[model samples]
Target: MTTAYCFDLDGTLTRQELLPLIASSVGLEDEISVLTEATISGVLPFDKSFKLRVRLLRDAKLDWIHAALSEQVEFDRHILDFIASRPEQCFVVTGNLDIWVKPVLDRLGIQSFTSTARLDDGRLDGIAHILHKGDAVSSLRDRFERIIAVGDGMNDVPMFEAADWRIAFGGTHSPNRLLVKLSDFVINDGNALCRLLNML
Candidate 1:
C-alpha cells in the first residue's frame, strides 16, 4: 500500500513559526505573535488569524522577508532528508501564504500546499484563498492508501482527524494539548521523528 506523509511547516518541520519571523522583519513580532498564539491555542480561527497577520505585515519589504526567512528558517534535517529520499510521498501542508513562504519551500524542493496570496500591482494585497488542513489531506485520499500527518497546532487538528496515523511533534515547543490528545504518537526529536516515520 502507498503511504503519504503530510507535514506542517512551522514548528513541525522547521524549528519556529514563519509568521513571527515575517513579523519580526517589520518590527511587529510581538504583536503578530499574540495573534499567532491565539490561533495556535484555538482561541482564534486559523483563517481569520492568518488574514489578520498578513494584513499587519503587508507593508514589509518583500526582499527583506525573503532574506529573513532564508537566514532564519531551519528545517529538521532528518525529516528533510527522509523527504528528499522519497519526494513524491511527502507533502508540506501549511496555512502560510504562498508568496511569504516560497523562499523556504523552494529551498526544501518538495511539493506543498499553502494559502495563496492575492496580489495588487505586484504587491501582496490579501489572501486569495485559505487552505483548510483537512481539505489538503482529503485531496490525497485517492493517491495513497495510508496518510500519516505530523503537526503541532490546533489548525492541524483536522489533518490529524483525516490521517491514518498522527504524530504531535514538539521538537521546538510543546504541541497543542488537543493535537496531542488525538495523536497516535508524540515525539520531540528529529531523529526519533524520522524513526517513527520509517516505522509508520
Candidate 2:
C-alpha cells in the first residue's frame, strides 16, 4: 500500500497551538480564545471563525507572531526522526499560517499546506481563509493511494475522514471527543505515533 501521511500542526505536530500564541502576542488572548473554543465546539463555521479571530490579530507584528510561535512550538522528536527516515511519504497539513510555522517546518524538512498570510504594508492583514486544512488534504488525495491523517481538533475532523487511517493525538491539546471517536487509531505520544506508522 502507498501510505501518504498528513499531520495537523498545532497541538498535534507542534507542542503549542499557534492561534493562542498569536492571540496572546497582541493582547487579545482572552477574547480570541473564546472564539477559538466556540469554533472547536462547533458553534460557528471554521472559515468564519478563523477570519474573525484573525481580524483581532491583524495589526500584530510579523516578528511577534514569528518569535512567539518559535518560542512556544517544538516538533515531536520521534515524528521528526521518522519523517527524516522516510521523507517522501510525509507532509504537514495545518490550518495555522505558514509564515508562523516556518521554523518548525524548516527544521523537519517537510512540506506543509496552511492558510496564507496576507500582508498589505508589512503587517498581517488577516488570515486569508479558514477550513484551509480540508482543502490541503483534498489536493493531495489524487496523488496517494492510502492517505493517513492525524489531528486533534474539530477543524481536523473533515480531513481525518478523508484518510485511510486516522489518529487523534492528545499530547498537547484536549481534543474534541468527536475527533477521537472517528480516529482509526488514537495515540498521545510521538513514539506511539511512530510505532503505529511503522507497523502500517
Give the candidate number with the greatest lDDT: 1
Tens digits of lDDT, candidate 1, 128-178? 999989999999999999999999999999999999999999998889999
**Minimal lDDT window, size 10, model 2:** 126-135
What lDDT score is found at residue 31 in candidate 2? 85
RMSD of 1: 0.8
Q: Pick the candidate with the highest TM-score.
A: 1
My TM-score estimates for the predictions, one after another, are 0.98, 0.90
- What ranges in model 1 sit over 4 Å off? none
lDDT digits (tens) for residues 80-157 of candidate 2: 888888788888887767676687678768777877887777667776655466667778767888888988889898
